[model samples]
Each structure stands twice: as structure tokens, then as C-alpha cells.
Target: MILAELTIFPTSEGVSVSRYVKEAVKALEETGLKCESGAMSTTIEAPDLKSIFDAVERAHEAIVKMGAKRIHIDLHVDHRLD
Candidate 1:
């Protein structure tokens, strides 16, 4: 599996982005990826890069739909054969 860590948020939305975060979470769910959300970020596991990319794309779209002109996304990936 490909393990991915994603931190997606708006840089200029406001002090709190709980609403947008929720939206992103929803988008992630819709992508059918295994995801766990933490206080500062979320971790997702996918079978391939396509699934991870789809999740990330959906997440970015969610933030943009929230009216954020500037968004910050931190993505880290770890791929293992075992």
C-alpha cells in the first residue's frame, strides 16, 4: 500500500478552518481511501498512486470551493513492498 500524509488548509481563510477541514474530510471519504484524521493532519492509505492523487485532488477542490484563494497542502508519501 502507499501511505500518504496530507495537511490541507487555507492560508488566508481565517484563524479557524474547521469547516473547510470538515469539507476536505468529506471529500476524502468520497474518494474511497482509508483515512485517519488527527489534530493537525490526516493520514491515508491507498493501493496505488492514482487513488492517492484522486484523494488529494478532491481535497484541494473542497478547499477551493470553500472560497479560499490561497491554500497550503503538505503531502508526504511512503511506499513499501511489504
Candidate 2:
């Protein structure tokens, strides 16, 4: 399993933060990733790196559709488990 911590900075818009977060969460879900928590930020759990990449790509697409001119995403993957 892989744990991904993502921080997304989307271009300024009039849309509500909740809406953006919802869209991001939905996109991740479509990639078969579990959205562990989502508010101003989101955390997702995936079975592998491919799923995580898929989720990230989907999230960027959603942000762009929402009128975001630019988006900065930081992802940290934890591959080792005790």
C-alpha cells in the first residue's frame, strides 16, 4: 500500500473551497483510491504508485475545469510500513 500526502494550490477563483475539495476527492475515488480525509486539504491511500499517479492526474484535471490557471501539487509517498 502507498500513502500519499498531497497539497494543492489552485489558481484563484470565486468558487467555494469546499467545492474544490469535493471535486478533488471525487476524482481520487474514481481512481480506486480511498479518501481518508478531506477539507481544506486531502489525504488519499492507494494500493500502488500507479493508482496514486492516476489520482493526481484526475485531481489536476478537475482543478483546471474549475478555472484554475495553475496548480501546485506536492506529494509524499510512504512505501515502507512497520
Candidate 3:
């Protein structure tokens, strides 16, 4: 499994952070990846690296589409489940 931690600072386009988070989660869900867990705080879950990457890309795109001036993303992976 993989874990992606993202920090997004979107422009003040009247779009709440929660909205971006929801869109991000929806995009991840559309990828058909298993989201074991997630949160609006700063973390998301995916079953594999590919899915995690895809999710990040989708999130970036979504923010851009929403007219975000800038966005930042950070990702972390943990392969050893022990």
C-alpha cells in the first residue's frame, strides 16, 4: 500500500478547502483504487504507488481547473507494512 500526504494552498477563489478535498477524494475514487482511509487534514490512502501518483495528478488538475494560483503537494510511501 501507499500513503500520499498533500498540502494544497489554493487561491482565494471562493472555493473552500473542503471542496478541493472532496474533489480530490472523488478523483481518487474514480481511479478505481482502494482507498482504505483518508482525511481532509493532510493524508490519503491508496492500494499502490500508481494509484497514489494518479490521485496526486488528479488533485493538481482539479485545483488548476478551479483557478488555483498555486498548489503544493507532498507524498510519502511506506512499503514495509511492519
Candidate 4:
């Protein structure tokens, strides 16, 4: 099992980027993974690293498509064999 914490936002969007954050959360949810949104970051659970990466990519793309030139992504992952 893989548990990841994703904090993604656009630096170029200036302050108050709730719109971009919404799109990122939407993208993550659309990946069909287990996602929980927090005040600071989002938690996602997946079966493998590939799924986590794919979800992150989707979220990044969503922010990019929203006209964000500079984006920041902070991802923390924990992979447990048990």
C-alpha cells in the first residue's frame, strides 16, 4: 500500500489560489484513488507507486491547463509492504 500527501499549488497565481487547489483536488479524485482533502494538503492512497505518480501528474496538468506558469508540488509518500 502507498500513502501519499500531496500539496500542490501555483506560485504564479499569486495569493488566494483556491481555484487552482480545487482543480488539483478534482484531478486527484478523478484518478479513482482514495483521496482525502485537508486544510493544508491532500492525502491519497494507492496500490502502487505508478498510481501515485499518475495522480500527481494529473493534478499538475490540471494546474498547468489553468494557466499557471510556476507551480509547486510537495509530495510525501510512504510505501508499506505489510
What TM-score, over all chains together, does every model reach? 0.95, 0.78, 0.65, 0.98
Tens digits of per-residue lDDT for model 1 on 1-82? 8999999999998799899999998999888788999999999999998899989999999999889999999999999988
What lDDT does each candidate get? 0.93, 0.76, 0.65, 0.98
lDDT of 4 by residue, 13-60 (tens): 789999999999999999999999999999999999999999999999
Which segments of model 4 are wrong by more than 4 Å?
none
Best-first order by lDDT: 4, 1, 2, 3
Compare the candidates by lDDT and give the number of the best one. 4
Candidate 2 segments whose C-alpha is farther than 4 A from its true place: 14-16
User: Model 3 Cα displacement at 31 (Å)?
Assistant: 0.9
1-82, model 3: which lDDT tens digit per residue? 5666665546555566777666766665677665543454346567667777777788678877877776666666665475
lDDT of 1: 0.93
- Model 2 C-alpha RMSD vs. true structure (Å) is 2.2
| Displacement of the residue 9 alpha carbon in candidate 3, Å | 4.7
Candidate 3 CA-lDDT value = 0.65
Per-residue error (Å), model 4, residue 19: 0.1
Least accurate 10 contiguous residues by lDDT in model 2: 9-18
